[model samples]
Target: MLDSVRLYLRYVVTSVRSQMQYRASFIMLSFGHFLSTGTEFLGVWALFDRFGSVRGWALPEVAVFYGMVNIAFAISEAAARGFDTFEALIKSGEFDRYLLRPRSTALQVAVREFQIMRIGRLCQGVIALVAGSLAVDVAWTPGRVALLMAAIAGGACLFSGLFVLQATMAFWTTESLEIMNTVTYGGVETAQYPLTLYREWFRHFFTFVIPLACISYFPAQAILGRADVLGSPTWFQWLSPLVGVGFLAVALRVWRFGERHYRSTGS
Candidate 1:
């Protein structure tokens, strides 16, 4: 595992250097990434302008939710960028090229591409996180701070897992990517606010089905010292992020299965 991690780091560094070589295009793409995601904050502001709060969650509170999901997704998107473009690999038969290599296909795909532009999204999330942390009057403690970081880590795992799953689908569905986008990208847009703002059914799907609430909503409530709407126990809130690790595990398992399927069927 240590060697694999070292190899992954080398791949990431090489990818960064390659992107840096195209200085002008790289800068424009980075700016575009920043601007596109930065627009979401405007939507949040617009919502606040019309309604004071969404289900009693104030703007600053929502910012916490926003920041958490954004940072998580940004990290996931950056690391798992290979999965995002997996469809193209399938179409062009480049996935078979990965198969010829000795490394794990999942790791190969993960390191195949890195979306450097998503750094813009990370910046936006950091800005929101800092602003929201200042706006809210939470009496911070060491443990609470640790839990917040854990939750973000968990959220990142959850999202990366989702990306893996999305890519795994290409083993069967090689040409289309629309449906998975709804879950991966749409999930990001939906989770940017407190889950309580949505209906019970939507909450149930996102919570029990995708487990988005486990990564963001429940943990944010715990951080803020608020009563959870869905009756989540305190223990669950603290531990929910670990579910993300599990989610990523499941996705990787599926990816392995997909790889086997591809090998069995490929020429």
Candidate 2:
């Protein structure tokens, strides 16, 4: 485990050094990311300005959800960038090189590239989350704080799972990968708001199926001291972080299946 961590660190350092070769481009790309996601924040603000609240959830409460998801997403995109962009790796035969390595294929794929630029988005997310917490006037208890962090970690894992699942499909065909973006990018957009604001089917899909709500909505309810409207019990809300491990397990299984398929077909 320590050796793997060291290998990943070396890979990250190498990526950062390579990115630094084009300092201007890196700066511009980072700024562009900030600008794009910053616009998302404006949309939330506009919604709050027009309507005092969505359902029973207020703007500040929703910001917590937005911030948590964005932070997790930024971190995931930065760390799991190689998997996130796996279609290119497969197309360019880079994934085949990964197979030649003695280390775990997943680990190799994970550390292949790291996007330092996404730190800009992460900074913005932290700011928004802090502002939201202050705006909502929620009392800070140790448990509440821990749960909030867990929610963010869970959301990160959930999104990372989506990326892995998307990449695993590359073993089959990369022709229609855009469809997978709906779950990845679309889920990010959807989870930014309170899940209760969405329709029953949509909410149910996120909750019971994709389990996006497990990271944000359910935990948010506990943080805000509200009751679940989706028929989930209170204990589940506190246990939302477990969803991350569960999602990763399923995604890994799917990935292994895809790997086996690729080996057999050589496609």
Each prediction's TM-score versus the true structure: 0.97, 0.95
What TM-score would you give candidate 2 relative to the actual structure?
0.95
Q: Model 1 over residues 127-208: C-alpha lDDT tens digits? A: 9987987899876899889988998899989999999999888888776667899999999999998998888899999987
Off by over 4 Å in 1: none
Backbone collision count in every prediction? 0, 0
Question: For model 2, how does the per-residue alpha-carbon lDDT over 118-168 read when each residue is reduced to its tens digit?
Answer: 987998798888999899887889999999889888888888888889899
User: Which residue runs does candidate 2 get wrong by more than 4 Å?
Assistant: none
User: Considering only N, C-alpha and C atoms within 3 Å, which residue pairs clash in candidate 1?
Assistant: none
The candidate that wins on lDDT is: 1
